[model samples]
Target: MSAGAAAIRVVVVDDHPTFRIGMSALLAATPGLEVVGQAASRAEAVGVVLGADPDVVIMDLDLGDGSGVDATRELLARRPEVAVLVVTMLDDEHAVYDAIRAGARGYVLKEAQPQEVERSIRSVAGGGLVLGAGVARRAMEGLAARADARPFPQLTDREREVLALLAQGLDNAAIARSLFVTTKTVRNYVYAIFTKLEVKDRAALVVLAREAGFGGDER
Candidate 1:
C-alpha cells in the first residue's frame, strides 16, 4: 500500500462472466491490490494462475467446465506459494470442508460484502486464513461435533435407538410398543439398521451394539 511497495497481484476464477468481471473491476480499484488475470474454468484457471503468478486467487466452487475444488488442488500442487480464496454461493459444510482439504487458504460466500472480500484477499495474500462469519461458525460446530462423535456414526438417530433397543434383547413387537410405532415401522427401522451395520442377524447386531456400550439402560 505504501510508496515503492508492490501491490498484491490477484486472479479471479469463476464460471460466471459477470461475477468475474465485477470482481476484477473491484480489485483493480482497490488500493494495494492488482487484478492480474481472470479465468472461467478449471483448465483456464490453472493456465491463468501459472501465467500471471498472482499472490492470491479468488475461486468459485462451481466451474461449468470442472470443479473449483479440483482446480484449487491442481493449482496449489503446481504453485505452492500461491494462496487460494474460495468466493462462491456454496456455504454448505461439505463444500467448505472440501475446499479446505483441497488447499484453499480462505473461504467466503459470494454474498460477503465487497469490503469483507477485500479483507479476505489481503489476509490470504499475507499467508493468513480467513472464513466468512457463517462459514466459520458452521466449520467450528462441525469440528466440535466430530470430536465427540458417537458410535456407528453412519446410523441415523432413530436407527441407533433401534439398535440400542435390540441390544437390550427387545423383539420387534416390544420395540414397536416402546417407541409407540407400528410393528411394520419398527421392522423397517430394524432392516435398515441391519443393512447399514452389515450384520447378518439380531445376534451379531446385539453383540456389536453391546460392545459399543449402547444397551446399558434398564427396560
Candidate 2:
C-alpha cells in the first residue's frame, strides 16, 4: 500500500463475539486497515458487509447460523468488487476449495500468527490470492487429483469418510472414535477403501485422499 493511501475498509464475520472483538481490535491497531463492521451469522454477514461496502471481508467458515462459504458466495454475488479473505479454523483442501469457489481471494487458518493474518488481508485487498502456510501444497495436490479423474467413483460414502480422516493423519482408533464405530469396523472400512481406491496401505490412502481433496466435515 502506498504511504498516505486510504485505509482499507474491512468487515469481520464470525459467530463468536470474542473473536469478532479481538479481530476488530487487531485490525484497528494495524496502520492501513479499518474494521468497518462485524457480523455473527450468515444473514448478518450479508447485511453488514453490503451495508459497510468494505474493501475486504474476513470470513469464518462456520457462522453458527450458516456456512461461511455460503456467506462468501452471497457477499460476492451482491458486490463482486469486494475481496473476501476467509479466516477459518478449517485447514483442509476441501475447505480451501470451497472458499475459492465461493469467490474468496484469500484463506488464512485461525491458528496462523497475527502477522500472517494481517498480511493475508493486505494481499487480498491488493488483488492477490493468499493461502495459509502449507495449504497451497494440499490445494495443488487436490487439483492434480481432480485433473486425473476420480480413480474410484464407486467407493461408498462411509469408506470416503474413513479415507478423509486417514488423510488428516487420524489413526484407526481415533477414526473409530470419531465415527462412533468399533476399531474392527473402522479397519474393515479402511480395507474396503484401500481395495476400492487400489491402494495398499494407510500411507497410500492418505496420498490419494490429499490428491482428491478429501478433507471435509464428516459430520
Candidate 3:
C-alpha cells in the first residue's frame, strides 16, 4: 500500500457498460482512487486484474463467462497480495459469504452509494474487512437459520448423547458425572456436538436439540 504519491490502482469488472463507465468515473473523481482497467466477463476480469496488478479490484458477482466467486479465488491464488472488493447486484447472504469465502475482502451491492463504494475500496486496500449495509446481519441470520434447518444429521451416537445431555440443561461438569467421564472428555464431546449441529453456542444447541426432541428420556 506504500506508493509514493501514487493513487491506489483499481480495476472494475462488470458486464454492463453503463455501470463500468459510471464506476470508472466515480473512481476517477475520488482522491487516491484510480481506475486502471475495466472488464466485462470473469475471464477478462482475471486477465485485466492480473495484468494491471491493481491494489484493489471491483468485481461483479455474475459475468457472462463465469462467476466472480471463481475469479476472486483464482486472483487470490495467483497473487495473494491483491485485494478483491465484490460489487454485484446480488445482496443475498449466501452470495456475500461466498465472496468472502473466495477471499474477497469487501462485499458491496451494485446499488451502494458512490461514497460507500469508495470507502469499501479504501477499506479493502488498507487490509480491512468490509460488508455492505445489512449484508453482515443477513449473513449472521443465515447462519442461525442453518443451525435450526435440520436435525443433527452429522452427529454420531455419542455426540447425539452429548447433545441430549446439553438439551437437558446439564452443564459440562454435570454431564461428565452423568456419563461417567472426565470433565475434559465431556467438554470435547460438547464441542464435537456443537460442530456437528452447526450451532454457535450451547443456547443455540439447546434450542435446536429441543426442537429435534433430544431432551426426551429415550437416551
Best by TM-score: 3
The per-model lDDT (C-alpha) reads 0.92, 0.88, 0.87
Which whole-number lDDT from 0 to 100 does residue 131 have in model 2? 93
**Candidate 1, residues 61-114: lDDT per residue as tens digits?**
999998999999999999999999999998888899999999999999998999
Judge candidate 3 against the unseen true structure and give its global Cα lDDT, from 0 to 1.
0.87
Across 1-219, the per-residue lDDT of candidate 2 in tens digits comes to: 688899999999999999889999999999999999999999999999878999999999998999999999998999999999999878889999889998999998888899999999889998999998767777888888785575456777788788879888999999999999999999899888877778787777888788878766543
Choose the strongest candidate by lDDT. Answer: 1
Q: What is the number of residue pairs that collide in model 2?
A: 0
lDDT of 1: 0.92
- Which 10 residues in a row give candidate 1 its minimum summed lDDT? 210-219
Q: Which ten residues in a row have the lowest lDDT in candidate 3?
A: 147-156
lDDT ranking from best to worst? 1, 2, 3
Of 1 and 2, the candidate ranking higher by lDDT = 1
**Whose lDDT is higher: candidate 1's or candidate 3's?**
1
**In candidate 3, residue 140 scores what lDDT?**
83
Error of 1 at 151 (Å): 3.7
